[model samples]
Target: MKPADSAAVALLGLTVLGLAAPTAAAQVEPDPMVAGQRVRISDGRRCAQDGAARVSSRLFGPVVLRPGEGGMAAQARVAEGAAPGRYPVTIHCASGGASFTETVTVRDARVEGLNAAQAAGGLALLALAAGAAFWLRRTVGGRS
Candidate 1:
């Protein structure tokens, strides 16, 4: 083939691949999940076939991924007494015929609660100061 024709063919092939990329991307589902939460996996068109969902976790060995409508679902359970951190979770499926790595974050509920409480307390303190300032301005200006 002529050089110009070959270049045109290459360009056409790239364009086609780019157009089909989104369909392939739809095959991968949710990622960066919270520990112990069930999340779904997708190959875009349908759920993983039976006995096709396999999961491996750094902290929890051999996690089970159940087949569900549209995809496969798996819950990355944090190990008992494990500290809060990011852990790797690997998912394998037949539809995509590939493995994907997602991170599961294990956070202590108590710590989250405490952080929330601290934020609320700070907001309350600011509100109180604003109110006090407004009161002082009214009283002092009335005397002037």
Candidate 2:
């Protein structure tokens, strides 16, 4: 197909995919990243009702839960001063309990940096698929 036809078909496919995609409320991806900006961490499990009296020293602040009912979540921040590498996060409870640790990566991002990565990955995939399609088309033509 011509370049214009190919581009139009691709655009139309994207339009359909966008319309068919699930709503934001259904997102189940781990909260490693949020708001296309801040990264978040949770124990992936709740703390005890009384809470962790002693939090690990490595943690930024006291691991406190939302004061109310439901699953208790200990909170910490991936601060702006924090490095862009992965940090080991551990939640310690004082009541002779086992602690849970999670490694959360905080990335330093500028709009241009993310844009470049997305564009590069998309182009690489497009190139690979176009090459495969050309090979398949050639094989079919040759066999016929």
Residue 143's lDDT within candidate 2 is 50
> Top lDDT: which candidate number?
1
Can you tell me which runs of candidate 1 are displaced by over 4 Å?
1-47, 111-144
Q: Whose TM-score is greatest here? A: 1
* Candidate 1: tens digits of C-alpha lDDT, residues 16-62: 87577655422222333344544444434333466656666665657
Instruction: Give the distance in Å from residue 63's predicted Cα in candidate 1 to where it truly belongs.
Output: 1.8
Show the colliding residue pairs in model 1: 27-42, 27-43
TM-score of 1: 0.41
Model 2 TM-score? 0.41
Global Cα lDDT for candidate 2? 0.48
Q: In angstroms, give how far residue 101 of model 1 lies from its true place.
A: 0.7
Model 2 clash tally, residue pairs? 0
